[model samples]
Target: MRARSHSPRKPKPNSVMGSPKMKSKSKSPQKKHRAVINQLDYLNSQCHMEGCSVSIVVHSTRFLICRHQLCHASDYFKDLLQSKYGSEDFYVTVSSMSEPTPSTQFRWFVESSIPCPALKDISDETLETCMRLSRRFDAKGLEMRCTKFIVENACSRQPIVALCWLNWALKHKFDAQTQASCLPSVARLSLTALEQHRHMLTEKIFSDLLAAKLRGTYDKAVQVFRAIHRMDHFSVEVDRCPRCGRTRDGMRVKVNADPCRKQIGCDRCHRESCEIENKAGDDLQAFYQCPHGLVPLNSTTDECHCQIPNLAHHLGSRYYFRSENGTILNPPPLSPHTSRTFDPAEDTSERPGTSYKRQTSRDMDRREQRQSAVVVRLEMLVVSLQPEESVRRAEIVSFGSSVILSIAFFYIFTMLNAFTTTNIALLDKSSGCFEKKISKYYGQPKKLWERFSRAVSLCSPRLHSVELGAFANTDEFKVPLLAPSEDCVVLSLGIGKDVKAERRMRDRMSQCVFIGADPVNESNADLFSQVGKFYNVAVGHKNGSFRSYVLEDVYRYQEVAYMDLATFIKLNVNRKIVDQMMMDVEHAEYPVLPFLEKGGELSQRDIAINIEIHRPTSEDLQAFVGFLRRNSLSQQWIFINSEIHPFFKHIRLFMINGQNKECRRRFWEN
Candidate 1:
């Protein structure tokens, strides 16, 4: 197809060929073969990538020029194309892969379906025909562009692939314009690149959240640490004595027990007998230290008898310890292997970027803030938590999927990152499971948390609301996000429990936007409004509700027109508080999620919420808490804080923020 070069004047071609005509006729075929080989060599130069590795198939078709030499099943490439576009589109693309000339390509574009038999059963002769056709049409340039695009677009979801394509595109001088146009073709080549890639995004991707959490503040850090634990599958706590199987409690006693309750044995009854009941479960109350030493399996439920440890045999006996052989016992380690695993009792060394100390100067204020309180149990650590296994490979996988190459597919990474994973939770304390996943991405973290708020409300410390402590609380709470100002060190609550903890907290917070309750009037707004206002502090009154909010009420509650009072609060407070919120509204807290999600008011905050559970069964609580958990509002401390704020000191503060504001590992132990 090379045009002959000539001077400005038209040449007399016959005059020159007259003598050489005989020679020219003999050389044309040989010259054609050499041209085909040269083109193939050129293509080979660019086919260095893993995906592009292919031997030049010397194929030729009457109407085709460039033939792909890849040797997979015809269905294989068809399938890959089908995934990127429809099966129809794939066939269309492949149908003309062998054609080299733009002249025949027009027919390919016109054909409804790609002709199959052409190279479907590729043979040496057919390959050669394809190569001949390609040279005639000079289609290699077009083919190369198309192939590169399809593969790259298809791989957009795979971080590795995406990174590769990014690098490749740059290497080949493919501009963004080319990337946009060719991305679809790339996607068509790699079928699996769809939503499946999201799963590949790990904790490493969310280092920003971690950085924010570790910036300095403790409450925020604790909240974020818990969240990181949740995200990384390193936070949920389940106790199982990996060493033994006690019919009663699953975990083994790693250490020797005190002398008083010495019925140590690996029988079903002893397993749970001494273990503390975390949330709630089956009771093991059927034993008596009677002479026979007989122990009933369960107090009233089962009439079955369980074995008792032969404590009389030895001094420091474990469940597995034995004497003269009697009945075979389930194996138990000599002692318990009960030391903490993921979330240990001992505090980990503080992460870098946070170091602050306590101040008695704030003591008087701390004393004043230390009003009445509930005997806290595992404060702040527990939220809508699922066992590490709850997070699915599929969920993350989708985040990185392609389909993005197509303009039809929305490339929304921010939305994927904003998802709050709280459902499909395997409770550390109880049994029961939930289901389902949401499609589409939401950019704001608060939106995801609001969704999970219902789920979190299922547990004891139902989330009334939450705020990031100028840190990780951003997903659920509306706090000011700011860059670090001054030395700006944030100490753990235990490390620096100022009596005026609230004031101290308010004073020291920096690198954060202030998030406070805007005091929206609550009496008139409907459930949704109240919920929205509650999330964003702009509302004038307590934005959220009392402790009576229920799932059904939210679903069936009357919708009331509302104003943006909560927005005002955020602008006004300019300070974020990580306090326990009491939202026991009859129906108020459920509906405002949409509103709170908007206006960025729900950007920061973690109000350790105490929502009133009003369902007839545990399923409702489960559903509610599951919702909250999915939304990223982990259910922290679940309890009533104050009945009334000090403004009415004569009585009490209902669900007021805790004065201690200090949450550390020893919280439960203390």
Candidate 2:
């Protein structure tokens, strides 16, 4: 069935250019048609892809359909006919006399096999040229990068063919700027003539990844990238550190020391003190204290590196203290304290004569005075580890006070236990000037406690509250309604129709400026007018086209919500900020979301978004919700109403700017 079936039968030079079969003038229609079919076969045989054949069409009287079935180029011919005729058939009446004949020409379609290999040989330099050309906004270089590279390097003359290749390259994602720049020259070419033949030259250049990108197939694009690099083949293994291999949690911290106690606190978050300090300093020995009063070092032993108890220690409920003399640790048991003590190393004797002469070289009288300065030594007495008498004395001096304090605390706690709830309430009212009210209940038995130990008493748009201080370390630490910072807050609206909804939102932010289609880009202060005023904006478009523009500045706000629109808006909204999104991007929300995630540089939409579900097949709506869940966006839509499309359900708004892992899992499943 293949041409290779008779490859050994080399064609004669005359046979290669096969002669057309002649038919008798008086022959019946069937015989003439049969004869024409035979000639057509011979002509096709001569034009096998690359061989004992010619690459040209021969004049014949054959019926194209029958001739095609038995010809070497049958597949190619079938394609040619179907493209020329979309199924309808007509019988052509052939006559011996003809007035004129249409000219027929052959064009070679460079198949995939050849182009792939050629692309493989393309140098990285050529690729760079291609990429650069893609971004260029010029005319002389308006050719497709690859085509231009080929022309510049391959052609010594024949500049015109290079131009032809340039025309060919345009199909492969020509730099839009180049097309625009070259528009003037193309104006002279008849639009019909240009459409008559495209040559499909650009199709040869797009590698799979590039094609996926052009198609906006982001997931496919990611997959194609994986293929190119074998990214999964490699992974990161934490380096087993050389010394001790302890895997010390290494990070830098700057410290500001307390002036009184010389204790250091973290510069970034003083709420908790950090132990490590690779902070900058000149004197390593005195790393704890700089003349500027900030000491940073890694020694957090009994004494901080600065040799001072950090004054900041008092800032926290937990604290640490070190004694210069271990004996001071247990006043009464001095003998036992000495038993655990080690002698301090003596300082090296100062270079005697060196200090003497240096003192003389500087201010003579002052130098003399410095050289004669007296050094003081304080002597410490050591107690003998004699008998139980010293232990008894330790108990009397140190434990005596602790014993009294403990007894006093016991009595105080016993009496106050009855008033714990009352005290808690009084503390709440008195100390909550800058905090929300706190609720109190008696600490109860474990089983009883589980019934009401924790609860979100109420929700408010606030950043500080008494409940927060009490539940600071609880599982419910993060607040959903409470946002990060006031400066970073925004109540944006995706104002489409829904005039009632818009009006309601406007009242909420009556001070914010409204920008509609044909927008008068307002001033910043005007945009945020009222105290807590918002900025009312209709994204990208002025008023009513399906086209949406990007709001780069809007992304500065941490959250964005849209009911309906295109995917580009979603994507631009996702990057940098946008912790929450409100979906409903036109009637196209569901289909468009998939594209935004799939094609754009978006891995996940970590936004609490709500959508007025557009009318979609049940399967599609489920899939869309599932997709939202997979990407970790909550999908609690409450269908309170649906007028335009019955399938469109206005569900209860379910969002998640910040929620637990379970919420995340439920929202973005995959």
Candidate 3:
């Protein structure tokens, strides 16, 4: 069969095997098909090269990526390549994904030559996807890049976007820095907007936002009140030339004594007779000298009636005036000058010499008239400068607005109070304990209930209370109206991320010494150390090593040293009587308070304590009350932090030593 058929098939011109045209036509179709495949399978065409070692399949889309390149770029890929199935091709299938999908993001991330992907051209949706994927795969570099971009770009421009980012970050438990950067924008959102997006925020964050809004409103009200109150009733005294009794504008007569001199002589009389003239003839003058260096009028002219200058005509001239406080006034008053029509028929024709004297006398009378006019103008100016009826009305409106805002704030504060659902028995004042039986107490045993009831009944009376730290996270205390001594000492325990209260205290009492302590050393040292000494130790029940979790971000923990209240006081404060003690030790207050009470450390000093009780149970409350009673501490102020927990989770209590005579004399008696 081979001997018969080998050379016989090449006869036709259109045959694909023999003709060049036929061969070219067949290749053209194949080329077009390949181009279509390359366009449709873009990922494979770009990534499926000779060096590629792994195949990543995202929603049935295959991407052949270089193993070393991808592993170096992503921690997820690094681990995946070292896994059991790493020797074979790897597949990642993401279902039900949106645009700028996981596969596309992965490709972009892998191909990115720069340390961080360029965010300019990337849409927010694409960036969000990158953030999500980076977080899932532990791509720390990409994660940080995305966080920085969102915070710096999105946060600064659009507050709503920033709020969204904040909600997302908070939900995912992002770093504290990221959350803090987004907080300002979130704080700017209106109550309505916040309510609309309330579902997106945590309860704690929502409460904080509301508090911030309230604080802003309060601040604006205070500013308006201050502005209204600062308005003064100003009066101006017009300065006049002693000789001619004329103002600067009316005394426009130049002297010929010296070209460089500002000495002004009377135009009618050639000699300088004003009080501003130098007696030594040195041309030295006072600041109140006449603007045109005018000389005095003739002495014979007893009542010269000089024409008063128009207020607008003297716009370029300087007029000296004194305020009611005896200070020089700038931009002198604009009251209209009084004018009188001259009677031309009053004086008859006279001899030449007598006419000169009569004319000079007439000019003097005109000058006197000008002086009277200036006086009338000054009086009008004083009346005009005084608060007008409209201004008074505006003031009333402002005060009314402030009062309304204050009432609104109070209403909100009271309405937001979330008390425990458990009913507390009434306190028996005589016995200093609850009337209900121990069995009736909610969830507590008999002994615990008795102690709790007794503690609850023991109320620490307050004489005077004042709120310090006007802004967010303020502190209330029983402070004396009189300023403390320069050697005053303040102890701040558990100084977490907030130093606003401390900073305010420092501003009020600059000479007082502040000492702060906290377990987390990250930013506490930098923040607290700016105003006072900072110690990296937790205030607890005992002095030893302990593990403490960060309050701002609960996921983070720190191995820190712990010091009891007494030990901390003795060591850091040099055993000095603490003037003010601020304690916010999360839940450690339960044990630390009892320990301090047992050790009699609080009783030994006349201390003003500002303490925050966190997540207190009925037993804890009883113990706290008992501790205060035993220490003879009077509760000066109390606030429930609804932001942390809606149901009495955090209680801020301020107390002062009632037994200490000095404390009573300093704060309560005053």
Q: Name the candidate that leads on lDDT.
A: 3
List runs of model 3 lying over 4 Å from the truth.
1-53, 59-79, 85-88, 111-125, 170-180, 195-199, 202-204, 232-235, 238-670
Please provide, for model 2 over 488-602, each residue's C-alpha lDDT reduced to its tens digit, 9 standing for 90 to 100. 2222333332223323333443433322221123343233342223333333212243434323345222233222323433533323333333343334445545533433322
Compute the lDDT of residue 595 as modeled in candidate 3. 44
For model 3, what is the C-alpha lDDT against the true structure? 0.56
Off by over 4 Å in 2: 1-485, 489-494, 499-575, 595-606, 625-652, 657-670
Tens digit per residue, CA lDDT, model 1, 446-510: 34323432332343222212223322111111122121342221211110111122222444553
- Local accuracy of candidate 3 as per-residue lDDT tens digits, 166-245: 87777666776777677778888776677667667766777777767766765565455334433421223345433365
Q: After superposition, how far is residue 646 of candidate 3 from its true place, in Å?
A: 13
- After best superposition, candidate 2 residue 126: deviation in angstroms? 79
- Candidate order by lDDT, decreasing, is 3, 2, 1
CA lDDT of every candidate: 0.31, 0.32, 0.56
TM-scores, in order shown? 0.19, 0.19, 0.36
